[model samples]
Target: MTLDLVNYEQKAHEAVKSFWSNREVAKQKQLLTGKADHGERAGVTAGKNMDGFLALVLDIIQANGLAHAEIHQNRSMLTLPGYFRPTKLWDLLVIYKGELIAAIELKSQVGSFGNNFNNRTEEAIGTAYDLWTAYREEAFGKQPRPFVGWLMMVEDAPKSRCAVRDASPHFPVFGEFEGASYLMRYDLLCQKLVKEQLYTTAALITSTRCAAETGEFSEMSSMTGFRPFVTALAGHVAAAAARLD
Candidate 1:
């Protein structure tokens, strides 16, 4: 059966819009009313606002016909054993009768692009290695290799769109990266993640605070577009369903 992609992009955009809107409202309501101290990080709990995006992904998975699979998103159940580490909590996980099916990680950044881009990249690469290595060690038991995916959302702003200067100090960076912006870097990152087989598919999406409410967003490349990401995921889910009761 063909996957229903009608308005999928807009739906994903709405999820992100809800996330940002909640964060802003929570911060303003607390700070402006003087109910919370400015030094206390009033909106600190807003980090989990991204759960909306997670839910949207789960919906897509279920719609693709794996609704009976043992899917997990709760913090406790999300933790899976790794070869390099004892355990790692993923954003989403799926299993069928104890057989590993798929795992996905979702991440987003609104500011401090320079300080966080490298960190995010490192974590993503490391997580994939750790999971696959663990699978190699039979951490999740004997089953076909599980599908892994990565999705990232970045705020569309001037700072993130401006090209960054690279300092190789020893060897010049790759030609394609010489004058790439953070968006381009992320696009390359997602594309390479799939190219290198680190993740089954990776998607990169961007939206601005002002345009987010209207469910407006843009894709950097077809490689990282939502359609490709969801299409790959649906295929994986369908395969896993054959093993389900």
Candidate 2:
């Protein structure tokens, strides 16, 4: 059967527009209420900045297959057992017939790229490792392996595009990262995540602040692009649905 991608490209454009618009709205709201956070934190502390992307993912799940799957987006229903911790909360979770089908993590970075990039990298690797180890121990019971996905959106700005120097006093860093930009680093991270089997698929996208008006975004590479990400997800969902038939 042909894979149903559900016209994700247009939906992705809309999601990008919503992402920027929501951030601005949140920032303004916080400022008006005298609760503005430091730097770009005010824009993200509202926590609903990614709702559009979440909705897009939900549409893909239902359109491709698994319309009846229980997709958890609420904070309370998103936690799963972890190997190194009591529980870890995911951005989204899919369960059908009492079996886990998929878990996805969605993240974005608008500013503070230097420190936040490192934090995001560590969190992504650690989360995947913890979940996979728990899966190895049958934490989700006797069932097929679930799809794990990670998607990130970064602001396309001069800072993110500029080459950054690595401080390696003792050992030289990898050749690929010697003078890579933050955006390039993220692309490398996503590629390695999939190559290392940390996540079933990892995607990276970039958009400027003006994307709020134009809904424009760019992909760094086809391997880590949004198209491949949704295609893999849709195929997995369709296959899972077939098993139920």
Candidate 3:
């Protein structure tokens, strides 16, 4: 069946918009009262806040006739055994008839680029490595390899857009990363994740707090764009549906 991507895009926009709105509300609430709420005390953890977007993905999965598949999103059920680590909780999972179908991780960054860029990159690479190694060791039990995906959303701010200096104490950094912005860094990260075969696909999206309400978001390229992400996911669900019987 043909996919209604336009509608899906609108839903995604709304979902992201709501995410930012909730963050702002939480921030403001913290200001009024000295007590720190969830987002205020710690930081923005959009992972749990992204259920709306994940729901859209679930819509695609269900539409493709994989509604019978086991979908795990709860914190407890999302945990999957890892090769290196004891267990890792994924953002979403699709299991069917004892076979691993798909696993996805969703992340977002609003600010603190300088402090968090390295951490985010390390987590992305490490997580993919752990998951793949576990699969290689048959952690999921003689099942078909699962489709892994990563989707990252970053706030469109001056700091993130400004070119960052790469000071390599020893060897010179690569030409592509000599003088790149945080946004560029994220784009490169996603591109490399797919290029290195760590993830089946990855997407990078950016949007401002004000623009989010208007459903405004930008993508670096078609490869890291949301359309490609949803399309690839939909195609995978369709293929998996065929095997359900």
Candidate 4:
């Protein structure tokens, strides 16, 4: 069956625009209140900059045939049992007929690229490991494997685009990462996440702060682009709907 992608390209453009504009608005609000955070944190402390992307994903789920699926986005309802911990909160969760359908995480990085990049990578990998191990332990009950997705948006700036060198004290680092920029590293991370079956799919996107008005964004590679991410999600949701029929 053909999958409906919900015209994600145009929607994604608008999402990007919203992301930038929201950040600016949050930063300005904090400043006006005389409680601004240092650096980019002022912009992200509101924690709603990624909501537009979340909406886009929700549209994909509904358009593909999961309109009846119970989607949880509230802070209290987004937690799932973890194998190593008590619980882990995801950005979004979908359930239907007492079965988990999907769990998604949306993240972004604006500055502090060096430290933040490593942190984001470790968090992504660890989150997937915890969730899948919990699945194996029957945390969500016996059911088909659910769709797991990770999507990241990073600021497209010279700091993120310039080549970065890693220090190898004992052994050499991977050749692919010899001089790769942070953006390239993110693309590689997303590709490896899918290649190793860690997640159903991962995507990377970049947008400038000025994109607040133009809604401009760029993808590092087709493999980790928004199109493939939404396509995989639509197919999964449609298949899940078919099974419920």
Report the C-alpha lDDT of model 2 over 1-245, residue by residue, as the tens digit: 68777778888889999999999999999999998999999899889888888998999899877988999999999999998999999999999999899999999999899989999999999999999999999999988889999999999999999999989899999999989999999999999999999999999999999999888999999999999999899999999999975
List model 4 lDDT by residue over 1-245, tens digit each: 98988888899999999999889999999999999999989999899999989999999999988998999999999999999998999999999999999999999999899979989999999999999999999999999999999999999999999999989999999999999999999999999999988899999999988899989999999999999999999999999999996
Best by lDDT: 4
lDDT at 20, model 2: 92
Question: How many steric overlaps are in each model, in order?
Answer: 0, 0, 0, 0
Which pairs clash in the backbone of model 3? none
| Candidate 3 per-residue C-alpha lDDT over 1-245 given as tens digits, one digit per residue, 9 for 90 to 100 | 67544368888888787777767666666667765555333335323556667888888888876889999988888988999989998999999988889999988887788888899899999999999999999999987668899989888899999999977899999898877999999999999999999999999989887864686889988889998898888888887778766
Q: TM-score for each prediction?
A: 0.91, 0.99, 0.93, 0.99
lDDT of 1 by residue, 156-217 (tens): 89989998999999999999999899999999999999999999999998988786468678
Off by over 4 Å in 4: none
Name every residue pair that clashes in candidate 1: none
Positional deviation of 226 in candidate 4, in angstroms?
0.6
Positional deviation of residue 47's Cα in model 4 after best superposition, in angstroms: 0.7
How do the candidates rank by lDDT, highest first?
4, 2, 3, 1
Estimate the Cα RMSD of every predicted model relative to the unseen true structure. Answer: 2.4, 0.7, 2.1, 0.7
